[model samples]
Target: MTTLRLSVLDQTPVGEDHTPDQALRASVDLARAAEDLGYTRYWAAEHHGSPGFASSAPEILAGALLAHTSRMRIGTGGVLLPRYEPAKVAEVFGVLASLYPGRVDLGIGRAGGPARDFPRRLADLRALLGEGGAVPHAPVPPQMWLLGAGRESARLAGLVGTEFAFGHFFSPVGGREAFEDYRERFRNATGRPAGGALAVRVVTADSAGRAEELARGLLLWRARKDLGEDAPLPSYETTRRHRWTGAELARAEVHRTALVSGAPEQVHAALTALAASHGVDELIVNTLTADPADRRRSYELLADAFALPPGGPETTVAHAARVPASVPAGR
Candidate 1:
């Protein structure tokens, strides 16, 4: 059987008035919980000027998560490469690798930086990796990965000598095609053996009914975000009030192509079939449930269904030292 790796994108409520410190602490706890559940990696995302997804500083968050866990590999689902100087990113990730040793990964994304600022950011990043830079006391050059929604990202990943990870779950191309495009380009670009791999994220649930119900909220939020609506803590009820039409619903459904929702045996069969058909090297499962308890349950259910052998620390609910009082539960 193909090995399945469970990973999480720690997202915080955007509209809520939570302090950054509180948000960081909560994210750390979540990562630790995922580690105890025998997850392979824990990742955070980069979002700017967005209230609904507050994890903008993935490097700092990666460091914190790394400090809190001993086994699980910590990384960014994607760092917005267009936003920061590549050198700074390299420096930051290098420091993290130094600190965490063999456990650091740097996942880069083409999104994040504003279009107006992209040129400068791209230039700086290139310069940093190109020439003279101060070496660290303990160098931690990260194993880089490129995350993109299209072919350009796949090509870039090949050029950069890093692993390619496509956002198949949220991208327009869906999973199988995206995986194929990435793998083909990776092989062509590097002229290396087909050993280099691709990783795709998906949302899987125990049942179609439950998955649909859970996906309703997630889909609605994504639709609203795509439309550039910035209401705070927007819920499914609010989305229903807006009345999404058939065309909009169809578009949303298209984006949901990678999602697998069924009974345990059914889900396992579907995922295994998907893996074989696509020649996917790694399957990164991203569950949609927001409630921490529900999220944990989802992980357990998946583990049982896949028959994943368990070998990790037991799950423990650590007392969050600084819970943000103003966090809006964006369920």
Candidate 2:
């Protein structure tokens, strides 16, 4: 069996009736909770011009997360490399890596608003980090994780000799083959064994009906966004009031696969299949909901469902503190 480790990829969603600041606070609080729950890594993603998301700068949010938690890994779920300067990115992560050391990571992707020279950008980033001239802390570079969904990204990351972080949330059709191709390319081009992680969205509740209800809100929000509706995500009650149009319904149908939800058994089964299918070393989860309590509960439920190690005995510590633990630790 492939050993599976769980991590987080937060979008800092602005839930219904909440402001962006509250969303950011929830992310920080959730990071603390994630640490207490023994999640290996907690990554924040960068999303621009989205009323529902507050994480425009994952690097800064990652720094905040590092300040709040003592041990969990923090990084960008990832940074759009083509959209930013490689030198600046190097400097940003260099400062973070020096401050946080092994706990910092940089997951970069060439997608959605990008140029064609991704491999070149990666090389430039590495080169900038190695120069030791512009950055005071250039000696300590953060771990690089290339984020992508298919073979081209796999191949690019392989050529650049960085780890791959595959996002299968929006696209999972050829996940297995893409991962396989990445491994093959890594071995052939880099002549080294490389580890890869998977990213996907998951929704869970106490029962199937409740989980579906949670799904309806997120699905409807995404459906609206896809149709160029820029308004913030509405409450589930409000969403329930809107009658669906045929065009919107069509978009919703395509987005249904992006949602994974159910009771514990069903959620675990789905996650296990996803892990087994890609043979991923880590499964990074993204859960966005109208309620932070519900979101936190979902993660707690997932932690139980996966039987993930209690990083320490103090697993009961909530979002605000990191108390000492009494149980056996997980890897």
Candidate 3:
């Protein structure tokens, strides 16, 4: 078995009663804690016009996360490719790489939907970031990754020579085959070793029962999302109080299988098996809970379960460097 490497993919979810600002702050807190707990990378998600999610600008969020964490690599879980020009995306991440040097990544995707021209845009972005690409003016190029759910994206990532990340959390079907196709077709003209990561939804607690309880919001949220109900994540109480129809319950059940929730030991075993099946060493955890505390706790438990080596003592922040009260704590 390949040694497991864990990372985070935060969507900055806003709960029913929470504000987007609060959710952003929680993301920073989680990134810092995740770094101290030995997570290898922290990738912020981009969601457009969704009150349920707050991180519409992952590049900006990535900058904040990079400032807060000392060791972990920071990047966009993806900046939706079709929404912006490739040159602009390259330039943005170029500036980020200039600031953070080797600790920045540029993960691009199609905004969680199908796009006919994604492959071309992806190639264009890759060329601009390549050796003779548009980012030559910057100090260094950020690591590039293509985020996809199926074989087509996998093949594109391979042909274009960027790292491939599979969205197992949302598209669990054919994930194993996707990975196989990626590895077989990978061709890096730049000569970087072929790399891949699998992203999955996970929830963990001290007990299996508690984990299940914490995941109630996610099941409800998934069901709601499937039915075109675009609202903030529901609280545990909200999920419990809401009535569930048969179709909604069935939809939730279908999504439940994609979530790996249990005690740390149980979760670890499941994740390990999943990574093995996908033939990937890296696993990106995307935990969405109504309570931010539960989301934070989930990462802490996974880090310990995976035995990831924690970072050394945190460097002291000068008094003058402390964030002012007027500013959000996460910023």
Candidate 4:
């Protein structure tokens, strides 16, 4: 049996009636909670022009997470490499890696620009990070990762010799093929073992009905966002206020397929099976709930179900005095 590892993928969602500042703080608190619960990693996500998300710069957010927690790796889940110069990215994460040492990850993504030259840019990035002693120095190079949802991206990651993280939460289909292609091509080209993780959205509660209820806000948010009605995630009360149109109802059902929600044991079984099918030992979970408390509870339940050992007795960053004011806030 593959020894399953659980991690977190935080989008830093702006939940109901919360400001972007609040959303970012929630992410910090959640990261500390995850570390205490023994999640292996806590990766911040990047989003642009999205009212529902506050994490536009994951590198900055990752730094804050690193300072706030003593253990658990922190990373950008990822940085869209196409938008910025490779040298600049290397400089930023190089600083992070130096500061945090072994606990930083630089997850690269191809969110924009043409795909043809992506591999070249990735190579350029590695070189800048001291891949073959080509250039700039990094005292401790952060672990490199390629985040993608398709076969081509998987193949590119393999050819470039970086760990691959499949975006099962972004694009649920074709995961098995992507994983297989990455491993085979990586082993053949680099003559080294390949590593990968699958990111999936999940919601767990004490009861199945409660889990579904907690997930309702996100479902509504997704349905509306699909129709270009982007807005902050609504509260469950607010979600109940809206009258669902036939079109919206149908759309919600489609989005529903992307989620795995239930009581603790049920969600654990589903995630274990899902990871097995994708040939990955790690599953990065992305959960969104209208209320921050509910979101925290969801992770707490999952921690118990997975039987993860606690990292230590550390309180959340909520105790402002615990974290130095000099520590920058997560963006």
Candidate 5:
């Protein structure tokens, strides 16, 4: 048992049959669920100009989730830094930290910042979140994470003195070296010492075949999405019916290669290995199943496998077992 902490990275996916409102609501519901399941944190993503996603403004959603749940840390899987000024971002998180104290996290991703300005923005952020800024009574400041994927980003994270969350789902090869670099170069001279995590795309089910089926199909849906298709996630039946073209199948493999999917034991072993090999304190899971129930179950099963601590209000949910009748095997 690796004792690896687990967190969530929710995109608030809007399926073909569901509305954006429903997707946002589901994010809240999942955050609450994550708290109960004993996950370490629940981080919502910030995506804009995407018809398939509902989490455009993660701070607002993060605040909502923090209000809705108790104990589990809540944050943006990353607040895109390019869209807003660093001081404003600092103030917003400062207020949130004042309200929730230790339960709030202000994770940053290199969204809008060009390479040269990244360090300056981080410096400004550090100053704004310092004792001189807003929240005086904040017992502890919001946890600052440098969400990165490559060598440069990792180096910047170490230089800026923030924890790192390597984006393994994006570029595995790049992220591996980046994680190593962060661990080697990290300097925790000032505030909280730097720790690191790896975020990966994961899928699991009752059986290995079912899990692979789900993983493969979900990859295809993502591929279609990257190609600018507004198609809703295909149902299991539809996935079964659609013949896979060579090109599409190859594209699907790109996603599938990074995905960890299988039965409970297999998934557990995979995650444990990943955590150990990467030397990360946590594994932030990004689940993208087509069915809401399956997605929820994946987290539940992982929590159980790790014997993670459960928190939050609703400890028992009968609704957990119910899967909508409409869902097919698709992603």
Candidate 6:
């Protein structure tokens, strides 16, 4: 069997009563659990000024994850490179690498939304990484990654000699053709003998019925965003309050590509087929289940279905300080 590394993109809820500290604690627990479950990485996303998705401060959260787990790699699913000065980002991640050593990853993206002034954001990032800046004493100057929806990001990643991860979960062209184009362009642009490896996000579940239920929850959230309902993100309870017409459901189906839901055997078959067909190097799993327990259970089932080995012994010496709760078995 082709080896598949499991990782999580944590978008768990931080209830209104919970402070950032508590929310971060919860995320730490989740990361530790993922590590114990033999996941290769725990990547958090960057979202500024959004509700429900409480991982806005990826740098701080990444530190917490690093402190809690010894082996699993920690990364930003993406830091909006366009949002901050590249020097500031370098400093932040530089500190992260210094503290955690080889466990840090920096995935940069071009998106920062329209509300923020784009031109100024771009200029800031350039200044930070361009030249004559205090370089972080990194072994290889950090493992940089570029994330985007199209070929431009792939080209940039190649030019910069960093990994390129395409946003298949949220982008419009998150299909086989897109992956093919990225791999081809990366090979040509970099002139590297080894083909470019790509990572994509997927939402998976134990059974088709449950998968559909979970997908409806995700689809509802996306639809609401498109509708411009700008309030704190709705709870799954609130998300379920809204309903979709048949046509709307069809649209959700079309948009929800790469999400696999079926019986355990069926899900495994589907994922394996996808890996072989696309030459994907990594599959990043994003669970959108409303309940935290349900979400955790989804990951457990997926790990078992994929026949992943249990995580090796925790590297306590490498990460002796600020260890979080020990992850429960069968995480």
In terms of lDDT, which candidate is strongest?
Answer: 4
**Which residue pairs in model 1 clash with each other?**
14-51, 14-52, 86-125, 98-140
All candidates' TM-scores? 0.75, 0.90, 0.90, 0.91, 0.88, 0.78
Q: Cα lDDT for residue 41, model 4?
A: 86
Where's the lowest-lDDT run of ten residues in candidate 4? 316-325
Instruction: Specify the poorest-scoring 10-residue window by lDDT in model 1.
Output: 316-325
Cand. 2 TM to true fold: 0.90
Q: How would you encode candidate 6's per-residue C-alpha lDDT over 1-331 as one tens digit per residue?
A: 5576556776545443345555567778778878878776777888766555677878778887888888887878778776676678877876777677767777777787552454344334433433324366443234556666676555444444446666656663543565566556545644553233344444456677766666666666555555654333335566567767666566667667745665567767776776667566466677655455556677788788776667822442242211111211110
Off by over 4 Å in 1: 12-24, 113-134, 137-140, 172-191, 194-208, 232-251, 311-331
lDDT agreement of model 3 with the native: 0.81
lDDT of 3 by residue, 191-296 (tens): 3356699999999988898898878788888888889898999998887798998988999999988899999999999999998888888899999987799899
lDDT of 2: 0.78
Q: Which stretches of candidate 5 lie over 4 Å from their true place?
A: 135-139, 188-194, 312-331
TM-score sort, best first: 4, 2, 3, 5, 6, 1
- Find the 10 residues in a row with the least total lDDT in model 6: 322-331
Candidate with top TM-score is 4
Q: Please tell me which model should have the higher TM-score, number 1 or number 2.
A: 2
| lDDT for position 307 in model 2 | 80
Model 1 TM-score is: 0.75
Clashes of each: 4, 4, 0, 0, 6, 1
Q: Model 2: per-residue lDDT, tens digit, 101-123?
A: 66787888786564457667777
RMSD of candidates 1 onward, in order: 9.3, 7.4, 8.2, 7.3, 9.4, 8.2
Candidate 1, residues 1-331: lDDT per residue as tens digits? 5465445555544323345555556677777777767666677888777656657788888988888898777788778877666677867866776777657767767775564564355334433433325244223345556676666665554544456666656552454565566666556655553322334333445676665655665566566656676534434345446677676577567656656665556667776776666566455665544344444556667667765545342321111111111222111
Instruction: Candidate 5: give the clashing pairs.
Output: 38-309, 82-112, 236-328, 236-329, 236-330, 290-331
